[model samples]
Target: MNPTTTALRAGCSRGLIELRQSLTNAGELLNHVLWPVLMLVTLFFVRDVSFGQSGFLLGTLVLPSILGMNAAMALVTMSHLLTVDREDGTLLRAKSTPNGMVTYLVGKIISVSGGLVVDLAIFLVPGLFIISGLAVGSVGSWLALTGLLALGLAATLPIGAVLGSVFTSARDQGLLTLPILGMIAISGVFYPVTSMPEWVQWTAQVFPIYWMGLGMRAALLPDSAVGVEIGESWRHVETVCALGAWAVLGLLLAPVVLRRMARRESGSAVARRRERAQRRVS
Candidate 1:
């Protein structure tokens, strides 16, 4: 086989192995289940509450919006894993091997994206049972939902990888969570963006998170729910444009950033990072 093909296969196998381990590990499994379960419980209590005079159930609106937010979170997960791996000498080990960076990245993508799919299923299945007003009966709805999910992942994952490459440490990674939480608040994960101030709506639209949530709402909510959306429509074209722009920007930057990060990884550097981490723990 060609060397590139060999590396790709190796990376894929590595990803699958890691994914299986994550699924089977008790701690990791709990991490996957806990949040979705909490969200479901929240949905259960609010499933019947009306969204003001919009006549939409708050739970029904939140279900898909949360899915989008979770999808966008792929960015954070990718960045977090990259930082951890770098600190633990994983990136250095890969750097010493032939085409190691390629294999490492491919493997990470598979594992992260695979884990995301499982997480989504965990949230979505029980969510469907708890919420009403979903447009799931039609084949088109499922297709659109799938497309939106794919676009969402594409939009966020590269940016996440780029973020991971830049942060240099887990402590820096923790700082990112605050801004992400703030974005979630303004992005309409649990409520309609249209309800926010006009400037707030525009500000939310500047990031991929809002488009993701909006796209998801377009997919799962009924036509009647459109009234609560910006422009009183799903704005599918704008969603595509926004997510696509981010995808392009992230893809363009990730390689450059990852390459720079890889260049700086050496045994002494990794050791120093470990020492710092240990001191923090102590």
Candidate 2:
């Protein structure tokens, strides 16, 4: 068997194991459940909300956006995990092994993506009970939503790996959250992007969040709901094109970044990071 194929299988198994561990561990389970529950509560309060003269329910619109936001956060998860793994010497261990970087990254993507799918389900199940305007039963809705999710992970995880490798420390990794929060604001997760200034709309479109939200809405929303979307259309082609661009850019960048970062990892460096982290905790 090819070394790459062997590494891929190992990564898959490793990811499934980590995912199982997270699902079973009380602390990890809580981390998974908390945010989705909070979003559900928020939706409950605004289930009947409408903006301006548009008759669409804000909660219904927000439900899918939250799903998209959760999907997009795969980037955050991948980066944060990479930072933690670096601090703890996981990357160093991988660096010592043949094809380990490939194995490690593939595993990380699977674990993060699998966990995210669970989180989305946790949100979507009760979410359906809370919001009524969605076309939840449509087979087409599920298929489109799944395709968008795959595309989203493709767009985000590589970029995340690149960012994670670049940051070099847990503290710096935390800083990445600031820009993500800012992106969410403009991405219009809580409301329609059309409500933003034209310049803001253009800026948001440059990032994957807006397209993710738009795609989610397209999947779950009724055609009539497009009235509130930009150009009063779902713009499926635009969404795909935008996310595809990000996917291509990220895929192109990740290997070079990860390779450089992996080469930098060493036991001494990991120990120094752990010491710094310990001192901070103390």
TM-score of structure candidate 2: 0.98
What digit string (tens of lDDT, one per residue) describes model 1 on residues 1-282? 888888899999999999999999999999999988998998899899898998888998999899999999999999999999998999999999999988998899889999999999999998988887899999999999899888888889999999998887888888999999989999999888888998988889999999999998888888888998887988999999999999999999999999999999999999899899899999
As for candidate 2, its clashing pairs are none
Candidate 1 lDDT for residue 100: 94
Best by lDDT: 1
Reference-based TM-score of each model: 0.98, 0.98
Compared with the true structure, the alpha-carbon lDDT of candidate 1 equals 0.91
Clashes of 2: 0
Tell how far residue 76 is off in model 2, in angstroms: 0.3
Q: List the candidate 2 regions with Cα displacement exceeding 4 Å.
A: none
Which pairs of residues collide in model 1? none
List runs of model 1 lying over 4 Å from the truth: none
Taken over the whole model, the C-alpha lDDT of each candidate is 0.91, 0.91
